[model samples]
Target: MAATLPIIDLQELQQSSSSSGKLREACEHWGCFRLINHGVPVSLMSEMKKVVGELFDLPIPVKRRNVDVLSGSGYIALSSMNPLYEAFGLYDIGSTAAVHEFCDQLGASPHHRETILKYAEATHGVAMTVAAKMAESSGVLASDGAGLFEDWACQFRINKYHFRPETVGSAGVQIHTDSGFLTVLQEDETVGGLEVMDPSDSGYIPVDPVPGTFLMNLGDLATVWSNGKLRNVKHRVECKEAAVRISIATFMLGPPRYTVVEPPAAFVDGGRPRLYRPISYEEFRVMRQITDKQAGEALELLQGPAQPLSTKFDVNSLPADVLAQIQDID
Candidate 1:
């Protein structure tokens, strides 16, 4: 049976002990949830959304000026896959320099940059807190610094779904799970079309909007980081009516090449084997691009013990060609 999108309170998660169980359950089962009082200021969210709508309303030529440091990290326009959808992306939102570059590329004014930077800073704080709580919920101790992703590569994307009268009942964006560890999204409050897959893959359940809140979803990297324990939720957007829907998404992706991704020892044990081999985010990112399964397939292919953690072992053990290909992902 399908379930409503779980609701979590960020303040409660931090102040109460019971929140740990709730957080862990939502991650393990639903893989997605709605969060309230997550500490991203309501005023900032409003300003950010206004800026996003304005950003997408700009001339195509100006929008196209945005470039990608990593693949698909730039302005994406209407395509065959989803002609009604367009988006602008910014990579490594945590870094001051990256945010500045994104603003400059879009030719944003000083006010726009201020709003964007402030919103990014607030969202990142919420993301890190939620991520750490998830780990603690699963038995990871605070002393180990389990929930830190402050330096992780985060990508912020503003999505605009152009829903015209003729496009009602159409797929604005295809059904897919994010490739990152998790995504924090500010969904359109008055527009309701985002649907998450039912547990059995039998149908879809709409995630209606709640004001002053954001939604979070565990993704492929989260599943790998949790050793297959966490669910990688798949979702899509449909056009419910003729209305312009705008949303902002902050994706907290896996660690960079310098910090190889591996399931914590707590998630791996004799009874439950390691479901994935440790690989850099770059390697995983390239795999997803080549395979074209934005959700799960590439991560699955990197599974098994054949390729162990590159660290604490000799890299020469793997075939030279294979190693070279993985290195090229960076």
Candidate 2:
């Protein structure tokens, strides 16, 4: 049987200790979970979905007006690279000013802009809540009980799958792990085409949409931050039917673009060795793009080289005090 995607209740998470364990396990084993009762308003969600559909329906020239503050951050059209997928991205979901700029860039109407801003606010809430849960599971207390993950930048993407009868059974987007920390996704309620590769490397599991809930996927940065503990879920889309699919993904991309993305000191210890060299989000993203490593394997290139074990150690060869004295030989 295929593995089942974990379903976590946000309300239950706040009231029970078992949910905490499930959250940790989801991060370590599955790297993704369905989140329900997450507090994002249902009406706002509906409005956002309608607006997303409208945005994608715009003419190609109008859609292309969604430029980026950074290349690869803006309008992505259906092309050979991803023939069945087209999307628009926003650089900083945490910034109200940035949200306005994104609306202006796309000529979003008053209602659309209103819905987008409200959705952005809700997305930030969900991201912060999940980030806190992650740190709690790792025994890292936010200095002020919160705000550690608040400063992180989030990038929002609205994706459209142009599925056709002829494209059924064909891939819409190739398999890949998200490049950020965690992604909060609002999937199409009527379609089912998303599938996540099993962490055990056995097979893929279809992720069916659950109404009034959001989907969360821990990503490559999650693996780095967790010292290789998190699974860094890899997933892809296929055209299962001839219906169009629309989804909104808000990625908690970690600290600002230029800031170093590193594992916490707590993650480095006697048994859990640090896994990767420090690299900024932008740098790692650029490296992956330049190298054409959009798949899960890209992380291997960033891994810290293995250290040679000391094979000559013999406890009997050292005096009682020699272990402390041997540190300065080099």
Candidate 3:
């Protein structure tokens, strides 16, 4: 029998401990789940899909104007690495200025611009809510979880896969793990091409399309933050047929550049050792790029002898400009 992702009811998550437990279980085991009742209206979702399709149809010159705010955070045209894939990205979708800038760059009409902003807000809400739950499930206090994400930036990517008859059975996207904390994805409603690596046997499990649901997945930052307790799933998209596919993803990228990513005190204890060292998000991202370990293997390079739990950087000791940046972020 084929493996299927666990279905997590967002509504039940708040009302039942069992649902919460299942969520944690899914995080530890599957690192992914199909989320329902996530509060994003069905009508808005449909409209968002239409908007994404239109955005992709924009002329190449206009799409090229959507430049990168961060590395790979802007227009990603079809390349040999992902021949079937192209994308438009926003460094921080939560920023009104950034959203409007992207809209202007893409020449989005008034209606499409409104839809994009609405979709961004809705998906970002779900991302934050799910991230808080994940942190709580990992034993971090509610206050701490809120603090961890309150100021974090959520990057956005609207992807398009131009699958052709010759590309069927080939990979649309290479298998890899997400580098962020969590991802909230609105996948194509009719296409069935996403697949995740089954941790139990290291085989692939088809992630079929299921309308009215969002797919949530844990990522590399999650594993480090949970002290290796949470799994960072590896997944890919395949060319299932000669049809276009679209997926909108919101990535809860790790802490601000000035802050380092380390497990909370709850994750580090006498029984559970801290597996990774404190590293700023930018440093870690650079290391991953330098080493070309995009599939989560760079985490192993970060593994070191455990340090005293009290070992930490002092905020007051930071350079004035860095501190100013941190203040602005918060």
Candidate 4:
């Protein structure tokens, strides 16, 4: 039988304990899941898609004006390494000024600009909610989860895959893990090519396009923040057919500027020492760039020194029942 990705309903996550368990399972094992009824209006999603298509349809010169506010954070032009992939980016979607700048650069009409802003705001709200739920699911946040994501930087990307029949079955983008904490993605409703690595058998499992639903992926930062309890899934896109594929992704990066990235106190106890040393997002980002460790190997370089076997236990490695027993004891 073919493998399937987990589908998590946002509504159920609040009202059902089993749903919360599923969220935890998805984070630990798959590192990604399909999110339904996530509160983003379907009409807004459709409007955003139409606007993205129109933006990408703009002439290369106009699109090029969407220059990088940060390295590789603006317009990613077509390249030989990934000829089928191109993207426009906004370094900070939470800022109204930043959104306006992106629109002006792309010569977006007022209506397009409004749609973009609305979509960004809606998605950002959803991202923060999901982040809180994730923290709650893992016991990182209990009563006070509201401020967990405050002031966190969010980057937005609009990806376009120029697929052709001749390119079918070829990679549209290389396999890699996301660099942030959590990613909220609006995938192309009519095209399917996304595949995530199945950690169990190391095989690729297709993530088919589901209209009106968002797909969420944990990233390298999530793994570190959770003290290695969360999995940062590896994924890729391929040319499935001779049709343009578009996706909008909003990434909630770790803490505010100049803030350190490390597991919260909840993740580190005598049983679970800090898995990664504290490092700022800028430092980590530069390290990834300098070493070209985009697939998450750079994280291993930051692993805390080995502790004596009797001093610590790998809670993530324990089976579900065993973990539950430990939690019960606590």
Candidate 4, 1-330: lDDT as tens digits:
778899999988877767778899999999999999998999999999999999988999999899643543667678675478788888778888989999999999999999999999999988988898888888775544457687888888888888988999898866878878899999999998999999889899888889999999998889988889999988988777999888999988778654777677778899988878776665565556556676779788777673223212222353443322110000
Highest TM-score model number: 3
- Screening candidate 4 with a backbone cut-off below 3 angstroms (N, C-alpha, C), the clashing residue pairs are none
Q: Spell out the clash pairs found in candidate 2.
A: none
Q: Candidate 4's error at 66, in angstroms?
A: 1.1
Backbone collision tally, model 2: 0
Clashing pairs in 1: none
lDDT of 2 at 239: 85
Per-residue error for 261 in candidate 4, Å, reads 0.9
- Residue-wise C-alpha lDDT for candidate 2, range 220-325, written one tens digit per residue: 8888777787888888887899998988889888776557666776677888777786766666655555466776576787676732122222323434332211
Worst 10 residues of 4 by lDDT: 321-330
**TM-score for every candidate vs. truth?**
0.88, 0.87, 0.90, 0.88
> Model 3, residue 194: displacement in angstroms?
1.0
For model 2, give the 10-residue run with minimal summed lDDT.
321-330
Better candidate number, 2 or 3, judged by lDDT: 3
- Please give the CA lDDT of all the candidate structures: 0.78, 0.77, 0.80, 0.80
Worst 10 residues of 3 by lDDT: 321-330
The reply for model 4, stretches above 4 Å from the true place, is: 16-18, 142-146, 305-330
